[model samples]
Target: MSLLPNTMRAVAATGSVPLDDERALADVDLPLPELRPRDVLVEVAAVSVNPVDVKTRMRRPADAPRIVLGYDAAGTVVGVGSEVTLFAPGDEVYHAGVITRQGTNAEFHAVDERLVGRKPANLSMAEAAAMPLTTITAWESLFDRFRLDASSGGTLLAVAAAGGVGSILTQLAATLTGVSVIGTASRPETRDWVRGMGAAHVVDHHGDLAAAVREIAPDGIDRVFTPSTAGRLPLYADVLRPFGEIVAIDEDPDMDARVLKSKSIAWLWESMFTRGVFETPDMIRQHELLDEASAMFEDGRLRSTLAREIAGIDAAGLREAHALVASGRSIGKVVLVR
Candidate 1:
């Protein structure tokens, strides 16, 4: 009764190595994943590499089984579990798969239905694949974590605005809301890319972030969103207004919250995997936000941030993508087409 294949090729991490080392990535044959009660089996058409894939692989145990490494993916639904109701066979969809499970680099991937959304009709599979992880991170950061009102006008400083998540965050903040977004980039090409994403102001984070931002907005920034918060905690404290909100997706244990003590700034972490990882009561929120993003993309309010495209979906392609991301110079997202 099922048309699904028994095995497929997947780009997996063979062992820990330098980011650009091709020997660390391999194209391996794997058995198809079993579907959970709320799962959908997706025949992957395209997938994008995120920094998480690179970071996770770097710290992976040497003797651990080869692990597939991808999160943002677009594909067609070929099968569904018993409890799946949101999608049917043949439906085109996209999702940022959960962190705990095997990922989306394989030919076929099994993902929870609640974390999947209909693909934007206007975008290609590769373009669609570039969105999920960054879109979800940006959406959740703006609405859920910071809880900023769309109608309220304030300055927002986005650090590393040329990167995957920051690019989308800049676009979302500038287009969907009244926020004045200031993006930080260290390179000319990336600065242009950030400005092209609709950032009102682009400044160099390698220089004085606070001074450059203050030049544009005499008043201090009301919110700050960044992927890294390691050594920049004190900078955030200086740039943010009193009682402002600061949200980051990366984990930095060295960051001391007391740095913002005088300003009473609110610090929060936005992990897109929280709902899927914990199976919380509001797990369906990812579905809701993703659907909204699809609609926005269809209506032309939002555009795909896919900047680089690779030809293959094999080990070599995976290594190339990981190397690009590690360079920290990618303007937007790097997607590998099947």
Candidate 2:
């Protein structure tokens, strides 16, 4: 293994401040992360900002230690823990690190081998960084939570299909399954982007969502994949078929799932962190799925959803990325590359 540095440059959230505040994120020097038995140390080449990062920043306690906030990353492995068997000193990899650990918005990050995958040969580090978290969320939602397969045929309504998770979910549904995808997009650019991701149809989600979806899928949706579920349950209940399933990635504490009971519809939540956070028996499934997805990416079956890229891994760039994501108007993913 190469001689690792004792300290590295990183950007951490100093406090729960608005994006406009200069103190929101700051550059600092931190000691290298200690590796556990299954950990692999990666020299982070690129890191992508997700909604979780923004939420975490906003909710950060003022008195707490500065928190490095990131999830999706693509990089080269420089060192491995004693028991790491999947990767070595020179593997190019990508992963969505667990929330419990220090994040990937740094010069180097240590992650579990089970949560990492060899980076796709066809993609740039920034492109690959755009995928891990969203890809895992979408993959688990479709195959794990909903249990949809290549043979399952039906109309799937993908809410906010222009967003990160929605973009990948639309592609996976269109490419890997027999389901016909009807993606929701509020803007012309987003609608076009969703169509490029292989959605069979695109509808505006701005107003009368159920009516717009009904125009494309009159019979009712067989499945629904949503990033946000707040105040949308009634709309879902109106559009979903009997016994249909809705898999969501976002949290909605006020969500009344009772509305779906009348239609016998199932509501499920997909948190990609579940396996890693709980140290589940099948945590390694993330690695397997990412490897499978890598092949798909190399073969042109799957594509990266990177829409914007910032040049450096610094506080300024991350704050800009955070602002873009928080605006809730950005399409696809925003990444910062070193």
| Predictions in order: lDDT | 0.90, 0.93
- Model 1 lDDT tens row, 1-338: 16777899997896677655665888889999999999999999999999999889988877778788789899999999999999999999999989999999999999999999999999999999999999999999998887766686888899899899998898889877899999999888989999999999999998988899889877688999988788999989888989999999898878788999999999998999999999999998898889999999999988999999998888888888888998887889999999
TM-score of each: 0.97, 0.98
C-alpha RMSD for every candidate: 1.2, 1.0
Worst 10 residues of 1 by lDDT: 14-23
- Please give, for residues 209-288, the per-residue lDDT of candidate 2 as tens digits: 88888888788889999887888889999999999999988888998888999889988889999999999999999999
lDDT of 2 at 314: 96
Q: What lDDT, from 0 to 1, does candidate 2 have?
A: 0.93
lDDT of 2 at 182: 92
- lDDT score at residue 309, model 1, on the 0-100 scale: 98
